[model samples]
Target: MTIFLGGRSRADTGNVISMDRFRSGRSVSPIRQAEAYWSALRRHGDVPNRSDIDPRGLENILEYTFILERIAPGVARFRLAGNHLSRIVGMEVRGMPMTALFSAMARAEAAATLEHIFLAPAIAELSLISGTNSRAVSQVEARAILLPLKNDLGEISRALGVLVADGPLGAGGLRFDIAGSNLRKLDIRPDRSPAEPVPGLAEDQAPIRRNAPGLRVVSRED
Candidate 1:
């Protein structure tokens, strides 16, 4: 993959690989490829809708691609997820909240990020580290990118994202350590001015609810 960042092209690393793994023989992270697909669909000024996404265009990175639908303030469920994601979590993850993949302490931050993605309608890139449950030995470093997407009703209530780890995820529960994140508003354009509306609720606030559904593992054949 040839990475073209900062208006320059770097050496082509391999058939399929992310810029982050320039030298590693590991499979491509898919974040970059996914971003390209999203950008291409953004021919109009508005965020692309779930229907705009073409799975075949994402063939190479399809295993790491996913679709999220917002269910409430600061909350989203996996409407569709790929095999690569299921591998990381050790089971089928459809219908699960995005935060279910994060460590206990990092879940609050994850929720905040999700809210930001919808309200601010921004793009989020996160750095993550994961470790095994029993030994606590750090296992892998990962990267994720969330791009805003509009639902069929034209509300920014959906997002397209890709997440990948540097190494294999072995058995047992694996939770990510939130390292850092970067968020960029989708409306930022040098030729235009800020126009998106501010969210009614506070940035860190989560909606109150009773008996929120928990994530469960289910079997599925691809």
Candidate 2:
């Protein structure tokens, strides 16, 4: 990924991994990808019925963050420019809303993408920074799509979005850590809730003793 933010400056960034990963139904944290596929199926102003959604597609749309809580219309939070994020802007956001993930300037950009997924209206892309506080800023890429959910009466209900980030995906694997290596991960909840799970492990395997539905465990590729 290459980003030319203010015009004169350009930066090399992460890849938008192929949509092939969307086919992995057994995989965890594929919510975003699944949502995109749903939106695609109902391309003519039509929304895919959740039942009509392929198992693989369905798996890709559930964010580990939301799955663990089993909450709909929830929020995912993160630091916009922490060492882990390694952006020009540096800040800590342990429990901030996912909306805090971008700057005001970037919000419109980010929102446009999210709305497509949340509102089931569009597709968007992003080039973000990694390394929360490490001073090592690496560019990452994100591609997302949104799909709409309809109720029994055909009223639109929920919106599903698929998100892909390519690059130094994580800043660490443990929860509530201040500084660490960046890797691909799902933080499990927007509140940084006391119920938060260990970063890289499945709820079933994580050392913590939680009896929730068991959120998926996503592994970072070596």
The most accurate candidate by TM-score is 1
For candidate 2, which ten residues in a row score worst on lDDT? 174-183
Tens digits of per-residue lDDT for model 1 on 103-127?
A: 8877877888888889877888876
Per-residue alpha-carbon lDDT of model 2 for 1-222, expressed as tens digits?
Answer: 222222223222233333333333323235444544654776344655544644454442333212101013433333111233222123444344445544444444443333334343222233243323323334443333334455456544444433444444434221111111111211112233357667878456557656556676668972
Q: Relative to the unseen true structure, what is the C-alpha lDDT of residue 85 in candidate 2, on a scale of 0 to 100?
A: 28
Q: Give residue 145's error in model 1 in angstroms.
A: 0.7
Error of 1 at 77 (Å): 0.8
Q: How large is the C-alpha RMSD of every model relative to the true structure?
A: 20.5, 23.7
lDDT of 2: 0.36
> Which segments of model 1 are wrong by more than 4 Å?
1-29, 132-138, 188-222
